[model samples]
Target chain A: MKVLNEMSVNFESRSVNEAFARTAAAAFAAQLDPTVAELNEIRTAVSEAVTNCVVHAYRDTIGIISMNIRIAEGNILIVKIRDRGCGIEDIPRAMEPLFTTSPEDERAGLGFAVMQSFTDKLTVRSKPGKGTTVTLEKRLSPRLSDV
Target chain B: MLLKPKTMFDGKVLTVYLSGDIDHHSARRIREYTDALIGELKPVRLLLNYSAVSFMDSSGIGLIMGRYRMMKLYGGSVSVVSIPPALRKMMELSGLGCLDVLEGGNEENESA
Candidate 1:
């Protein structure tokens, strides 16, 4: 994939950063001239991934959350959200719908599911004590007029 | 994190107008605000107006589910209205359609 544009951002693991991350990524993705729905889909997927970092990864203690966005050939948008916090011990169980480690927190455990549904491809890699990285990619099909 | 949930009471129906995105941060405040109202007023029907909600992730699902459970304890029902299509899809995919009444437009309850 030939990268046309790319940018990376690092922010604190605060809940407020959730919106910031999503908006920043969306603005960067705007270069591809995606439609409103496509832009929203990208934003929503980024929101879920970033929220997971703020809520589950850091878990009260402040940490660093980084996000990288890259626009590749064919208007393919790639997003990577990474955090150096307590990693997931059970990846399979964590990805299961309605399976939340912090059920008491009222989490529906639908983060992964939402990401999967919004993006074309989703990948999660984590080390128990190291951190977790979520990679999401979506090919934004240009509007009929643009094509 | 702009979670300014405005509540209007009309007899048995309590309508809350939720604005901004519903993420982990704002969800806590929203939960607190609505839960306090539900605890005090105990309305028979709780209506959540999401017309102004621009973005909502899975945390929105948690908020809805939590409110649903809370309302259920008091034998009340929860309904979401004016949900944007983007959010409607999220709610639908999360199985929230089965948990609460989802309607179009922002019509005030005539029955109150």
Candidate 2:
């Protein structure tokens, strides 16, 4: 699949950045002319991925979070959020619904579950003492106004 | 919009009306404020009004679930009111419907 356009942004691993990441992803996907519902789903998925970086990845320290968004094959919106923080030990268990490592923060352990449910495709890669990367893809339908 | 949670206590029930967006950052603040109030007021019922909430992600699930657990421990119950369809769907996806009552189907009298 040939890529149409791509953009990358880096932000600090801060809890507040969760909203910024979501808005940035939504704004980038806006050019695709996605529907309101589609846009919302994309934002939510982005929020979950970024929040995971701030909460679980760099639990006690601050780090850098990189997000790359791309449009592929004219209709597929791909987003990759990467963090240089503590990597996941078990990917399968982390993806399970309500399986959270930080219960004191009231984390429902639904971050990965929500991302998987909202996006068309969700992938995660990580290494201990390194970091974690999450890639999400969604096929967008053009908005009527842009058509 | 700046994140803020509006809290009100109607003698028996403490109504928390949340506006703007609910994410990890704001959820923590909301949890702290609501937990303090719930602990002090000790209301028999807790009503969470999310009608004004514009955007919410999975962080909301933790917020609601934490409050539910808090109320349950106090021998009280929690009810969610005026949840928009999209947020309601997200909550349902997290299996919250089976735990707490989703208000709005019946008439709600805030003054009651």
Measured by lDDT, the strongest candidate is: 2
Global CA lDDT computed for model 2? 0.88
Cα lDDT tens digits, model 1, B11-103, are 898999888888887899999989999999989999888888888888888998899898999999999888877786788888877764777
lDDT (C-alpha, whole model) for all candidates: 0.87, 0.88
Provide per-model DockQ scores. 0.84, 0.83
Over A10-50, each residue of candidate 2 has an lDDT whose tens digit, in order, gives: 99998888889999999999888888888889999999999
Residue-by-residue lDDT tens digits, candidate 1, A42-107:
888998898888879999799999999999988899999999999999998999988887888899
Where does the lowest 10-residue lDDT sum fall in candidate 2 chain A?
Answer: A138-147
| Candidate 2 structure quality by residue, lDDT tens digits, B1-112 | 3645778887889999888899999998899889999999999999988877889998888999999999999999999887877686587788887784676542456422
